[model samples]
Target: MSDASALRKVMAPTGVLRATINVGNPVLAGLDVEHQPFGVSVDLATLIAHRLEVELELQVVASAGEAVDVVSREEADMGFFALDPRRGESIEFTAPYVFIEGCYLVREDSPITAQEEVDRLGQRIVVGKGSAYDLYLSRTIEQAELVRAPTSPKVVAFFREHQLDIAAGVKQQLEVGIEEFGGMRLLPGHFMTIQQAMGVPKGRSPEAAAFLSAFIEEVKAQGEVARLLEKHGIKGASVAPSA
Candidate 1:
């Protein structure tokens, strides 16, 4: 092997560097153009694979719950999705890469237009099972009667079909839903901030952690991550260093 290849192998961990991220538009922060999954998270994973000179596998789970399962079961070497502190004990996070805000989506004709409306009177808030918004509603809006969808797309469809009074999703996700389906509007405020991170399986090898940290640092320092985010018109996101 070439010296560079040899050095890479030395730094690389044994086995495949598999990764799974959502396939949704704006999959990473707000970086979806042409309704594609060209988000910053996708760019970071692809870049890491290139630098490590290792195979990169990308998997798309239908929902966030499945993404969590991918890492927990060792089916994926890493998972890139929104972070929940409750999940930290089950997996190791490589520092947050992006931050997201959650909001409620409603039909344009719906009476729920503002955050206060959601707090006081919102009735049916559709959300995916195990999604951040589902958890948030369960805590904050006890009377809201949260409806569960199996995937983000189904959540959007629930609202469009008038089966739900509202759907909760990230700001960008709601935007994508509106553009794709053409009849929804965002409620006036946010429920909470969602931090996005790369997660390694619990008790992962040290070499795996080293490679992820190094890959993230290089992507941040070289501006590759930023460039990809910009290419997709994502604004207001910055890479957080791995802790």
Candidate 2:
């Protein structure tokens, strides 16, 4: 079979390429009033479908964990996510197409004035389960007790309800938390920098992964990623380097 035919067969076995999008990650995507997915991930999925000559379908989920579940079950052909080693176990990621900062948000009057101050003993840090920062903290946090919220947005509520010492998440998410909850302040430096990328289920044909990887590089090279970020008025996300 021709490479194009093989690509279509593997990427769209159902005749529709369902791309799972996590709108909770504001740096990558968002939902409209109608709850339709929008932003960079939407644009990328649309372009992928156009490139493959396949019908496009979106599996919109409330959080990244839900999107991860869709890909883990191989229910969706592809999804967008931050490149984390933990998620890589069941997902094959293309080179990252964008970068966003992960940081801590503390109450304005809290004693954790710096990022360094967060890991001290007795510090109670709340993070969303399965988020990029959650993965990072899972590996690095030793002394402080890490609290897990059901989702990223809920982390702030967890922090407030329990009076947790800190909340860790994407920088934009914490910024939104401040607007909604007040008394929240973001640390000056990033705990980590998340590399957002496209991913497919593990165990797919190597050639299939290669095709999507090359497509990602091509899109980044052609400046479509930059155009989308600017068009969306997204200030926190920057196009990732071509790999």
Candidate 3:
């Protein structure tokens, strides 16, 4: 089959490219005033669909884990996610198109004043279950316990409700949480930098995965990624360097 034909067959088998939009990652996606998904991820999905000559269908979900599930199960053609080894089991990710920070937030009166201080006994770090940070912390944290919030947007609320020692997630999200919840302060500096990429379910045509990687590099080189970040008013995240 021709390259175009193969790409279409693998990426839009149903004649529409279904892209999973994880609205829980506010830095990449969120609902607008009308509750329609709109953000950098949404725009990139549109671009990919247009390039494939197919209709675009956004499968919006409330959390990163749900997004991963939809894409991994092939219910969606593609998704945006942070680079994590556990998730790579079923998803083939492009080099990151964006980079975001994973940070820690704590109550002002709490004694956890430094990033290193978080990984101590009796400190419970609240994270969105199945999120990239959750997966990372699960594998790396040896002492502190993890309390899972239902979603990233709820991490702060979960932390507050449980009086957890730390709330962990996107720095931008944590900043918003501090404003909404009050009495919380982010530990100076972030713990990890999340590499955000577009990915397809494994077993799709290799040509399709190659196309996604090329698309990411092209957008980054052309400044389309930067434009999207600015257009969405996203702060504290930068376009990933070309792969």
Identify the leading candidate in terms of lDDT: 3
Mind giving the per-residue lDDT tens digits that candidate 1 earns over 2-121? 864654453333444677777642546222466444556667777777776677777766677788878787777787767776667667776666667787888888877788777555
Kindly give the stretch of ten consecutive residues in candidate 2 with the minimal lDDT sum. Answer: 203-212
Candidate 2, residue 115: CA error in Å?
Answer: 1.1
After superposition, candidate 1 runs with Cα above 4 Å error: 1-14, 29-38, 235-243
Candidate 2 local lDDT, 66-112, one digit each (tens)? 88889989999899988888899999999999999998988888877
Every model: Cα RMSD to truth: 4.1, 1.1, 0.8
The count of residue-pair clashes in candidate 1 stands at 0
lDDT string, candidate 3, 84-198, tens digits? 9999999999999899999999989988899989999988999999999999999999999998999999999999898788999999999998888689898999999999999
The candidates, ranked best first by TM-score, are 3, 2, 1
| Alpha-carbon deviation at 179 in model 2, angstroms | 1.5
For model 3, what is the C-alpha lDDT against the true structure?
0.93
Best by TM-score: 3
lDDT of each: 0.70, 0.88, 0.93
149 Cα displacement, candidate 3 (Å): 0.7
Question: Which TM-score value belongs to model 3?
Answer: 0.98
